[model samples]
Target: MTQALPSLKDHCRTTVAELIRICQDRAVRSALRPLLAGIPDMQIRAMRYLPRNAPVNQDLLYLIAGLVAEYPCSLPEPNNVMSFGASLYKLSQHPDIKATGIERRLESLLQLELDSLMQPLHSLVVQFSSTQSSKTSIVIDYATLLYHLRCWDDSRKWVQLTWARDFWCPKEDGKEQNSDETLDIVKS
Candidate 1:
């Protein structure tokens, strides 16, 4: 029989080290120095590969949660943030991990995103409404994000607005789609 492959832990560690090296490159560091300033060196080193590692290990999840708590403003790039969130979402759905630890960090990250938006509900509504073309999916996403953030009043307002728009606006096929299911999900 052939020798077994390296353990996942060892593979992850090597991947993380290579990722750290990329982050530490002179040109990369020069470009990212300002963004990295407030974050602790150790946290930055771990966070550079968090999107890759967080899905595979609980320890990495905890480390990332701690780093986010310490440096709420030091958000990763949008793509990385999306990947991180997706990983956490997957982990949170696992029966073994559900409600044990990952849920809390996922909630914290959702709150962090809401806090980062930094605009009141009225402003967000106005901003999205004033655009020449409104994307229903984006409106729904914002409403869902607010719901997850526990901004009940704001979320309700958005759901109502979105429902009204869906009802009143002419559909491409001249038929109105019921948005009650979407509204119910947000209300919950």
Candidate 2:
């Protein structure tokens, strides 16, 4: 028989110290259901990249930071770069996040992720969209993601979410390359 899990309250405790480690696994422990954990790594890391750390609107910065400092996106090394950016784009809009910290870091990460992942995503979108859509289908558009990020003018925020894919891209010198991409949390 399997043992029971921990409580949700026991999981999410906002602290920069834990951000680095929890980033490896957004969902450390869950009871029987879903629970909010830590800040998305991409957003936190993104905060590191902002050219201008100036607060967008004082109150909002802290709020966003608190949220960023709290979200938990445990994506793997490479693919996570994009996943975190996207997660932040959504989270920046949250009222709590806006009241907390710098949105620029999140913005910068988003931009960076998109810049690197776009062409590949573009091709993927083209190929996938061409196929038939099932009753339940999820579509992530890499194009204009920055535009979407900028739209965090109201209540929105990125949270600890995870996604996976098998994306293929060309080598820097134009050679075709494909890898079995897993977005981090692999259910072993």
Q: lDDT scores for all predictions?
A: 0.34, 0.29
TM-score of every candidate relative to the true structure: 0.21, 0.19
For residues 83-154, what per-residue lDDT tens digits would candidate 1 score against the true structure?
233323333333434334444443443343333432232222232233314232111122122222333236
**Best-fitting candidate, scored by lDDT:** 1
Over the full model, what C-alpha lDDT does candidate 2 score relative to the true structure?
0.29
Q: Score candidate 1 by lDDT.
A: 0.34
- TM-score of model 2 (CA atoms): 0.19
What ranges in model 1 sit over 4 Å off?
A: 1-82, 113-188
State residue 84's C-alpha deviation in candidate 2, in Å.
7.2
RMSD of 2: 17.8
Q: Provide the lowest-lDDT 10-residue window in model 2.
A: 29-38
